[model samples]
Target chain A: MSEGSQGLLLAGVGGQGVILASMIVADALMRAGHDVKQSEVHGMAQRGGSVFSHIRWGERVDSPLVPLGSAEVLAAFEWAEAVRWVEYVRDGGAVVADVRTIVPPGACNDHRSWLRRYPGIDGELFDSRHLKTRLIDATATAEELGNVRAANSVILGTVAAFIDIDNKHWEAAIAHLVPKGTEEINLAAFRIGRDVAEARVPQTAPDPEGFSGPHQIEINHVWCKGCDICSRVCPEYCLAVDVDGKLTIIDAEACTGCKLCEALCPDFAIEISAPREPAVVGNQAAADGSTL
Target chain B: MTDVKTYLREWAMPHVLCPGCAHGIVLRSFLNAVDQLQIDQDKLAMVAGIGCSSRLVGYVDFCTLHGTHGRAPAFATGLKLARPDLKVVVVTGDGDALAIGGNHLIHAARRNIDITVLLLNNSIYGMTGGQAAPTTPEGALASTTPAGNTEPNFDACKLLMGAGASFVARVLAANPMDMTKVMADGLDHPGFSFIEVISDCPEYFGRYNKVGGGAEMLTWMSVRDEGVAGPLAEKRFVNHIPIESVPSGMETGVLQREIRPVYAGVRKVEDHES
Candidate 1:
């Protein structure tokens, strides 16, 4: 909402819904009035490799990259990744992390002997140095409320508390970002994550100049075969991919009317247009939901 | 002497081709051959069937016909018969030349009609979204066959030679100079000359089969082309050494050349007099 930008880092191993979680947070930031710039590590994403999303939001964000140790928030989908990306967090930045620990294979040949030799705990995560940390059992919370897949949503909600945005905006983001039928449980997971993180102090406020405008551009999801070509070509780094590998808008406000994405699309799936008055949701049925 | 650009109907262009398509190179080679020969443009008649390569007939400044699907040879036969003085050429894609039009192609070669056939082989039916064609390589993925095509492909050059074509050559789109030379030679050949161009359809075929787009496909073709594999080895090894063997790679040069009796539906005056 101010002159300066906000940097957030999202890190996780592949298949943990890290990209989708970042998409939700980034979309909500744009709706709350900032020009969001989002970028992700797409390589080695299918092999359970380290993945990170760089999200920056402001009136006029110049770059999609977050310089090392400059991020205000680092949301880790797993405790091991929490320790892995802890160095990226600014000294005063907040970290909302999943308490679940996933040890890489071969790290400990025998879990029983390793558990006895070194019990896993917060302090075991080599000194976090001065960065503020709030570890949450988001997986337990999500599974208690019916779907372990919503663990990503719970972690996102936990991170939502450290950032300055209304609960309603987060609700709207979940509705627009998540698939159709799973909205109810995912929202429940979000609320649980927020309640779990209520003890922390929010370091920033929603941008007073944040984009409270309509979404521009319509994608004929029917033509989108989950190709990353459009997302890679967006001039303002506004397009992002969802869990299904389809393109989802991250910062519609950052669009400069450049039709490169539309023109380069092999399927002609993207169409740039003026924002509608009603702020209609995008082609929500995924590509299968399009007019095949 | 008209150049290739001059031969092109400027108003009809620019020719629609997707990024990374080999069809452009093949089309350019054909135009370059026509340009090099300084052939009579007014007397040139080109017939094409329905497909991406068939669209070539619409852009060339010749007496061109483009509506028939897999029946370009049938149309070319009629054109050559009616105006025996015209230098007629038929262009078709793998599907058009070897599938629905297979019979027409074999018959055209059998009769040894005085015409040239340019078979643009991209391996799959590209215009219809990467369907498996008769020329599609075995085990390659197609839209209709998501689990890899189980059917084998046709070797157009061998098939044409078996059907008694007077001139048969196989060329690659990557080697434009050689392709043009073969094209010009085919045009100059007296009886049915069939040139099979190993071209690429990157949008559909390349995408579905995981083949690197046009450039990579071209690079592969260039490397796969082991030049002049058949004739010389046959002369040196088989006839001289009394050995029986065949070359391993795709034979590149002209496979066959012979003088054949042209079918005109009637005996010539010399034959009648004799």
Candidate 2:
């Protein structure tokens, strides 16, 4: 850790132009007459996996990896990724995160409750870390400027406000790195980001009613022909056929109320009933209503 | 969100279709479409000809007519013409509509009558103990063709499209949601709506062709679909059956839709004077 040396962290999901944004940042830093080194991990980026890059700049830079709790700022392209990499920023460091959520495929494993494993957009979490948080709807701003793909440039513009670099270097780097025809749009998006106001973060939504318990799966044995359609289509594997070719509920507690079995059952033998009582187990925040 | 069971004749529970037969799913999807459209159950006429698919009309609590083999279209056309307010739907099988009642089916389409024909093609004559039918793919084994039929199968969608059906579409039992969507679209179409549901006869077609059970048969159908890929398309269901036995590149979803004049029959004297 040398004096005047600062690290910047960028985290986002795949296909969000995380690598391209990092290259633009490093290029801007180079144009600002600083020693800049950038490294990124994007092996699983094409499959909608997590992508991150570490950028460090100073009079003399040794490593591109930004050690934990040493970054001056963290730019997250998605809500979940913001919460994931917020710890990397030092105390009182800035965090610029877009209020966009991309629910991953792995978060859908809990088929019993149908509750996503994503966190809510609560600024209190960052407040507890004693860090300066700047939430912005960069995607919306970029979309309003006529192209949603310029969202990363908008975020880079916001990051410029925190760094001591002049706007001319960022403009030059954006013009040099952006696609052949999108340079104008990217430049306009950057100016909007540089002067953008803090977006209003909404409160966490209340949990949906009548989702406290697993749904009840009723099977009419008389109508069921032991076809194996319901059991096979059940995402939770809640139903099965016995040795005597009779439908049976092997795991009633795992029913997610998805009703795929009930929908695809040929005999009308399967019926999914919601829990009889609307007991409030706990407050689970719903997904944010923000959109790009 | 009325329960589809409300439209069913509870006494007819446990339908006579064979185990793993997809006709039950088709019936449920149809009831869903009817419920979505909010059609009056009494004003809805379901006509069926003698076949495993035709038996679906007997289970529904509607103005149902069990007609002679391959004559469901004729019955539906007559019913629609007499009671123009009623929503007439004909449930027929591949053999009943394509083989035995081919003329009536084509004539109904040619007239551009306001009747929805849901031709459930299981690719075999399931009601007659798995005999070869007109829609049965070539080289597929059936009771009548133990050495594999040396004939080409009929593409039901193409046949209906060529017959001047204003609305032509195909769906599969494997994808019930899309089936419901296309079924609803067909019911809403004004004239000659023909939807061919690629249902599965696991007891007959699956066992004879070694395509596994109802679940495997659905996976096979989904794999062979050339329409927009769905969630089931990505699943690796470990199919061991030979590739050539099952038909491939069969496109699903709505194939054609057009606006045309509907055959409303002879108008009354008061209607002409007005």
Best prediction by lDDT = 2
What are the runs in model 2 whose C-alpha is more than 4 Å off? Answer: A1-5, A14-48, A53-69, A98-102, A111-130, A134-161, A165-213, A275-292, B226-245, B264-274
Clashing pairs in 2: A266-B25
Question: In model 2 chain A, where is the ten-residue run with the lowest total lDDT?
Answer: A283-292
Candidate 2 residue-wise lDDT, B185-261, digit = tens: 99988788999999988888889988888888887787678553344555544335444444667888899998776
How does residue B88 of candidate 2 score in lDDT? 91
Query: lDDT per model, in order?
Result: 0.74, 0.85
Where's the lowest-lDDT run of ten residues in candidate 1 chain A? A201-210
DockQ for all models: 0.02, 0.62
